[model samples]
Target: MYENNLLLERGAARDLPETILLSDFLLDCQVRNFSPRTVQSYKSNLKYFLSRHPIRISPEDLKVFLVHIRDEKGFAQSTVENYFAALSSFNDFLEWEGVIERNVVPQFRKRYLRQYKDQRNEERQLINLEQMRDLIDSAEWICHKAMFVFFAKTGIRRQELIDLDVQDLHVSKRYAVLKPHAKRSNRIVFFDDECAQVLETWLKWRYNRKIRISALFIGVQGSRISRDAVYEAVTEHGLQLGFHNPEGLLNEKFTPHCFRHWFTTWLRRAGCPRAIIQELRGDTRKEAIDIYDHITQDELKEDYLKYIPKLGIKL
Candidate 1:
């Protein structure tokens, strides 16, 4: 029995190649039922790290890798953070498998990445109500108009908007059921009559086209719109209306995300309650009080209709 126990312990502690470890870690991610996108992200990040440093991961080597990505490769702060997150998850897996005594990625992040304040929020473009109207009106295509109104009124992320299906919308109800997203806490978003009208017109036009796809929005070829296409459509209209400047700073340029900023800002200007705005924006409840503050869908819709600005879209 003593010899058998020794053999079990030795097998448990057997050394594995870094590549084998990475494959195992990824398999663990799959076993946990992580989304395909998430699993792909982990695989990509780990593969890049392994390609650079083919040996065992150490805190010092990790630091060097991070510096190389941040400084030499000029990756954005968010991208760098994503890389760190992948590494941290992998380290946790290693520690769980007894490959390491403890995970050090959290400590490394606190000592390095967590010190800087993210200024992207501060530098986001803020357009006024009239300018928003101009942007909607200037759209050459009905699809573009509907998309802009949806973004400005709903304040959903680009990916969320793109993921919307035809069945998710209730045109008469002036509401939409957004697809599941990691960051979005609430899946419901409401729009005003102006937005509804534009959407109805787009739907009619889309029906005329007779595209059989389930996507709420589509391209010229009757396929679900790509992310780049959405970006281009928004930017094109923004430039035409002088709301976007490609040569300007982050604050001076209007992007699809700017609509979300506009929605939040205007809702506050209209004196919407913080909790109501939070619910409408699908923001995660972070505090203990937030957990108990349950605002009903009816209340949310009532406040939303009262606060959502009128763009006077003449469709």
Candidate 2:
């Protein structure tokens, strides 16, 4: 049960002059089964635009408001387009409820001819077989070794791995469902015989330590491994292997997401279909799934073997 605490605040209607009651619109979206993350984004964007442009004005004034944001506020064309989308949905809701007679936001589309593109582009980093082997061989902690092997094999998102709970992994079923902090998607990743065996070995080692923890991976405080911890673990191990200098390898710009990108790229080169690769990475976008539609699992397995020959355990 999501409370409407954030959506509706006291005197919000009176204080917010131009903006509609966005909470109502968000509730509608929720009822329609839109993903929670999508609803949150819509709410955030709409509130940001409206709060910044809060002035008593007619529907026709939206054009001037948009131009002001673009020219004076220095918002990029793409960001402005996203603002229009958020407001358009809210305005449509208002129009339906008799708050306004005309769809002013929809008219902006024809007036501005705005084009929207995703701005959160990710950079690609390919960690080849040799680099991965070196990192694994240098791992001082058995748990860290398991973490490296799990990431190298599965390509789970950094957040997904961070969010992994011991109970979430059903070894008998050969699958794990990771619920990430993001609301966009949940990932269900499979584990083959090799990964399972390594995981089992790590679990045995953990048991011998006689510590109680629900997280598959834990930090110094016995809490779940965070993004920072996982990253440090990877970088430290890589540096220990002499594959990279401490300063050169753990640069701020390079991060766990790079591992995910490398994993996906490797999968594509191995001949796995784009859809399968996207599915493996827990991506929900159809466009993302279409890019590598020509690959096969057999080719991917062969590629993995060529790179990590020590992984003699077969699927």
Candidate 3:
């Protein structure tokens, strides 16, 4: 029996409603410390699925739903894939809970990536060092300013950024463990002395406030910051630093993810080896593990320092 906890509402029924089951699944995700953004996506997607189908769905119904979503609803391949992923997860949960005897869904997952390869954005957008400095300097809070520096120096995803904790930073070593969130891998990301100084300033403020959260970055409300808040803040400042690009459809300056792209571009321009760049960028480890297996964090930091962003402009 699932307990009334977190977002789950209380009910007086022995048999769990689909609503309660979904709530339980979300709680399970929270227990595993999944990102709030990811949990929200899963809940939204799976609820949409349940609205179309019953608590128990046949393989035929799943295939029909997939076809309807693709042809009638005209959902993009990627959106369909997201729906497929959430439904598959729900199916797995149901099977585990013994609510269903078998696990089968529309094979909406297969070939979605490969078939829509050209449709996706592979653009490697970049911003100049000057613009990077402006975004960092524009941040009002010292903590947000430090976070801006962290993004500019390290090519971590938004998910990975929020996953960061104070313990992850090693000032003496000039490196931080950028733990995996979403598609990223648990890896070391090194920042320069300049970023460290800014971070320490924020740390002093954070320590004085004494917020009881483990998150490295917190909002003015003294709580762990949400991913949407980070995105909005980064975009708000980044837009002032660079011009819009009509060709790419997404200007680097208008997105928090642009920092990661810019970091990769700068690292390559600095002549860091492809393998080292891949490691620092947290590329999909499925193929590059053999190449990076022997590499040490010390060696990586040496390479990281050689071409670290030199923003003379301070926050």
Candidate 4:
């Protein structure tokens, strides 16, 4: 009798509409400090699933939905995986809240989605030194030039770059402190004299404009620059130099992330030791030995300055 009662209670808990549960989940995401873009993505993916199925979902229902999206809707494999990820997260929430007896999405993914997953590796675009120099030189604005130089010098992720504030940068010291992130092992990144020169020029121009925002990079209205703006800026310069092709594969088009590849590749070529390069890249240490291998700031800066490539752009 107790077992039957427990089953009834679980069913009743799941009777709540999908929209209500989604709202609660999104609220929890906000409380956990998820970025706005990520929360919106979760919301959209869950809404699409709810449109086809009720909140009281079963493993069979999930399998059918995945098949429909992949086979009938003809979504890309990655996009299908994204939809499943959103559903899997929601299932975890349901299980945690006691609305469901167990989360089945994980098992379903392993059984159904794993077999079809793509295993091929994709290559990224890597421009040579002369091309990189020409790309930076062709930028019409000091701000764009500084941004390009900074990305090449620091090898930080795009979001990390966007999160920068004027206070985070120490121009005289030729280094900047990146914000804390789960994936980053180091918070400090150093720049060379060329990068510092371009940054100083941009800062001087920005200060004269009387912009009051603390962001290191700003849009026309003195607001923080968005990710889209950065992509467009990089693409514009890339296209002008015949380096970015809209109809090309991943390796054929130049993007902001390519700067990181260029940085890592050239530093390796310059004979910067593997440990030092990893430290400068801020990659999380995975090995047990990696945790014990400490690279001091001064040492890192010295090697970074020694190895970082120069673009030969006249200030």
Question: TM-score winner among the candidates?
Answer: 4
Cα lDDT tens digits, model 1, 1-315, are 997886675457438878788888889998987766788888998889888874356789878998999999999777898998998999898887777777888888888887544445557889988999888888878988899999999999998898899999999998999988778898999988888889999999888978679999887667888788999998888888786898787887888899999999999999999999999999988899999878999999999999888878766
For 169-218, candidate 3 gives per-residue lDDT tens digits of: 88777888877565665477888989889988888887787766889987
Pairs with steric clashes in candidate 1: none
Model 1, global lDDT: 0.86
Candidate numbers sorted by lDDT from highest down? 4, 1, 3, 2
Task: Point out the worst 10-residue segment of candidate 1 by lDDT.
Answer: 114-123
| Per-residue lDDT of 151 in model 4 | 93
| lDDT, residue 275, candidate 2 | 55
Candidate 2, 81-194: lDDT as tens digits: 777777788777666554556667776676564343343443444556666666666676777777877786777767678768888887765567787544334356666666
Residue 249 CA displacement from its true place in model 1, Å? 3.5
**RMSD from true fold, candidate 2:** 8.4
Model 3: residue 262 alpha-carbon error in angstroms: 1.2
For model 3, what is the error of residue 244's alpha carbon versus the real structure, in angstroms, after optimal superposition?
5.7
Task: Answer with 2 or 4, whichever has the higher lDDT.
Answer: 4
Clash totals for all models, in order?
0, 4, 0, 0
Which scores higher on lDDT, 3 or 4?
Answer: 4
**Candidate-wise lDDT, in order:** 0.86, 0.65, 0.76, 0.87
